[model samples]
Target: MADASLFEVDTDELRRVGNTMVGIGDDVAEVARTAPMDGRGEWGHQGLAGAGDRFGARYRYLIEQLAEDVDRGGVSLRGSANAYEEMDAINAASIAGLGMDW
Candidate 1:
């Protein structure tokens, strides 16, 4: 395993990735909003219609949950980038205070 101290983070890259994740989450949410899986009157048989409705409800619930989770992940990633950037700034300031150029 690589040493933790040697790890490097690209804040810009993190922000970009976070933004992409957010976009994907938004797209997923749009899908859930636009394509509701309510197969009530479509099925010919009553039993099949009921089953389809149940499945549709479950699918909508799961998709909504997934969208929320993904959005949270993206937000977390963006927050992490900000935290890392701040930490880097503090470290550089500390280094500069020691009569050194960082």
Candidate 2:
């Protein structure tokens, strides 16, 4: 798609993505809040930490999307696409502090 921004055809798709991300984030947070805690439960923080990890992942996706839209002055189409995946891989690598951290 020559001259296509990541959002050139349908900006609404991005909004849908964003809304989905927010909804998931909210769900995660709510679960963390309401879930029962163990005695002396520093482990309860794992749920909240997992939620933050999810939000960070969603934010990373948004950033990768914006990068695709940027074009970077004639980068190859495949290169542009690959960049986003690589960004995701890097983000996934850095995720931490989630119980088993899975």
Candidate 3:
């Protein structure tokens, strides 16, 4: 296996991926909110319209859930990038201290 120390986090790439996810989530949310649905009417059309309403509601719910999940994933990725940087700094400080004979 390769040495773990050689592993490096590309924070700029991570941030770009995260931003992309966020944009996708936003687009999904917007589409879900704005998409047109069938209208209600008398006779058989009413039943079909009712069914369509139910299906549309479920669809919107699912889309919103996916959007939320994707947005959270993006936020988590960005947070991880920041955490890795902080850990790297701590490691460097610790290594520097070890070299000090005091």
Best by lDDT: 1
**Cα RMSDs of all predictions?**
4.1, 20.9, 4.4
Question: Which ranges of candidate 3 are over 4 A from the true structure?
Answer: 1-6, 40-44, 100-102
- The order of the candidates by TM-score, greatest first, is 1, 3, 2
List, residue by residue over 21-59, the lDDT tens digit for candidate 3: 888889888877964574544426767878877888898
- Measured on C-alpha atoms, candidate 3 has an lDDT of 0.74
lDDT of each: 0.76, 0.47, 0.74
Candidate 1 lDDT, tens digit per residue, 1-102?
Answer: 111112378777778889998899988887777545454787688898888778777887888888989998898889988888777778778887999876
lDDT of 1: 0.76
Q: List the residue pairs that clash in candidate 2.
A: none
The clash numbers for all candidates, in the given order, read: 0, 0, 0
- Which 10-residue span in candidate 3 carries the lowest summed lDDT? 1-10
List the candidate 1 regions with Cα displacement exceeding 4 Å: 1-7, 36-39
What TM-scores do the predictions have? 0.82, 0.29, 0.82
